[model samples]
Target chain A: MQLKILYFGMIAEITKCSHEILAVETKCNSNQLETVLKKKYQQLQSISFKLVINQNIATKTIFLHPDHEVALLPPFAGG
Target chain B: MHKKKTVFIEGAITPDFIANSIAKHQTKKSIGAHNIFLGQVRADEIEGKTVQAIEYSAYEYMAELQFHTIRENAFEKFDLTCMHIYHSMGVVKTGEVCLFVFVSAPHRKIVFEAIEYIVEMIKKEVPIFGKEVFEDETHQWKMNTV
Candidate 1:
């Protein structure tokens, strides 16, 4: 499965890309994806962020799907 | 149930634009009360420097999804006739509007509650970020603890 991931705010600065497509197994969940990303980019391990799957914020157990728009987002500061 | 909304992840929301939006809603005879919440960029002295603007960013897709969900939830929880929410994306200068939430209902009570709920949800659930820019161009990220 090819998942498109978006990085926002400071996360984008750290990741150095706004969005990217990664090929992973269809059975991979949010946690698995996070682990894979952390292994690739070690700085991700120190930041607090949320995983949004298909435009919705999801828990670590949320399953991945092909073409899902996933975002690695940091905490909100909007008033 | 209201018409599809206008959602923008822009630089700053202007006062004239907001006034125009309010004027456009004048035809709604059923709405008696409207409550609006405007979030402004504050100039504060932090670390011996003054803040100039806020560079805003968001998880665009997820922010829209959360905003839609917040809209639906507000309609379910309150008797609102209409609602509007807009937030800034890039550099919003100090004293400029960054976020605006407007809600209308037949009475004052529901409008008040709906607007508050909408703003709260946007603050807590949406994946928006603010980077505070100083006069010297140095920046510090804003973190919301709650």
Candidate 2:
């Protein structure tokens, strides 16, 4: 299955792309995706971000559902 | 259900607009206290360059959802009469108001706490982005370190 990923704030700056669709195999959890992302984009390792599934923040150990809107959210600076 | 409230404004929020908002509330006899929090764009000196302005952006749909949720939670936890939140979109110059949070209640205590909590939650949860543009025309993305 494929999951659509979004990058925001400082994470988008490091990744140099805002959004993309990444293909991941079935039964692969969120941890595997994080590792793959860090490996693919080495700059991502330097930044801290949250993984949001369907607009809700999730932990690294959480499972990824293909139907959800997945995104990488950097720390917010809003008031 | 209440109508959808606007949380975003084009470009920057003006001091005059904020003053007008405060003026509009002057006649409310039930409001014993009105607490407000305004976020101003800072001119930060980073890497020997000074920031000139900040460009703001957000995932609007998600931001609206988050704002509504915040409103609901605040209303539940506090005895507020009304609340309003306004944030700028696009370019906002240094020293300009980027965000305005207003809370009114019958008394002073709850308004203060509610305003603080709402501002804190917005900073932690909203999908807003800021790009710091320097005087030299160079720019860098801004993020919360906490």
Candidate 3:
């Protein structure tokens, strides 16, 4: 499956791009994807972020789909 | 169902805009009280670097959805007559307003409580990010502390 991932804030700085398409295996959960991302971008391991799957915070394991919109969000700093 | 509002502004929220918003509410006779919260960018000295401004960005799609959810929940939780929220995008200099939240209610107490609740939820739930730009053009990401 191919996932469209969005990067925001400091995560975007580290990833060097705002959005990208990554190919992943079917049934790959968020944690597995996190590992894959951390390996790809070593700086990601040092920062705290959350994975959003289809606009919802992925607090638990969520299976990835090709059509799902994934986002990497750092800690919020809104008023 | 409440209509979705455009909450993102391209730059700092000016006093004129806020005044206009309040003026437009004059026709709302049922609203007895209006409480507002304005978030200003603070020039904080961090490790000898002074913050001059904040460049804000967000996952806009998710942010709009989150704001909508917060608005809906506030309506369900409080007896609010109306509510409005606006946040800055791009650059907002220090001492300028970055966020404006206004809530109107038939009573004074409800507006006060609802304003605080809505602002707090926006701080915690919204996925907006701020990049603190320093005097020398250096920058750092800002995180909200609970």
TM-score result, candidate 1: 0.88
Q: Give the per-residue lDDT of model 2 (tens digit) for A1-79.
A: 8889988777777778888889988876788888888898897788777787877777547777778787887767775
Q: Write the per-residue lDDT of candidate 1 for residues B1-146, one digit (tens) a residue.
A: 55557676578899898999899889999989999999999998997999999998876666777788888888899988888899888889999999999888889987877887888888898888999999999888787767
Query: Highest TM-score among the candidates is held by which one?
Result: 3
- Model 3: pairs clashing at backbone N, Cα or C within 3 Å: none
Evaluated on chain B only, candidate 3 has a TM-score of 0.99
For candidate 3, what's the RMSD? 0.7
Model 1, range A1-79, lDDT digits (tens) per residue? Answer: 8888888888888889998888888799898999998887788899888887876778548888886778888778986
Task: Report the lDDT of model 3 for residue B10.
Answer: 96
Model 1 chain A is weakest, by summed lDDT over 10 consecutive residues, at A51-60
The C-alpha stretches of model 2 lying farther than 4 A from their native spots are B1-3
Residue B12 in model 2: shift from native, Å?
Answer: 1.1
Q: How do the candidates rank by DockQ, highest first? A: 3, 1, 2
Pairwise lDDT winner, candidates 1 and 2: 2
- TM-score-superior candidate, 1 or 3: 3
Chain A TM-scores in order: 0.90, 0.88, 0.96
10 residues in a row with least lDDT, candidate 3 chain B: B109-118
Candidate 3 local lDDT, B1-146, one digit each (tens) = 79999999999999999999999999999999999999999999999999999999999999999999999999999999999999999999999999999999889998988988999999999999999999999999999986
Residue B119 in model 2: lDDT: 93
Model 1, runs deviating above 4 Å: A23-26
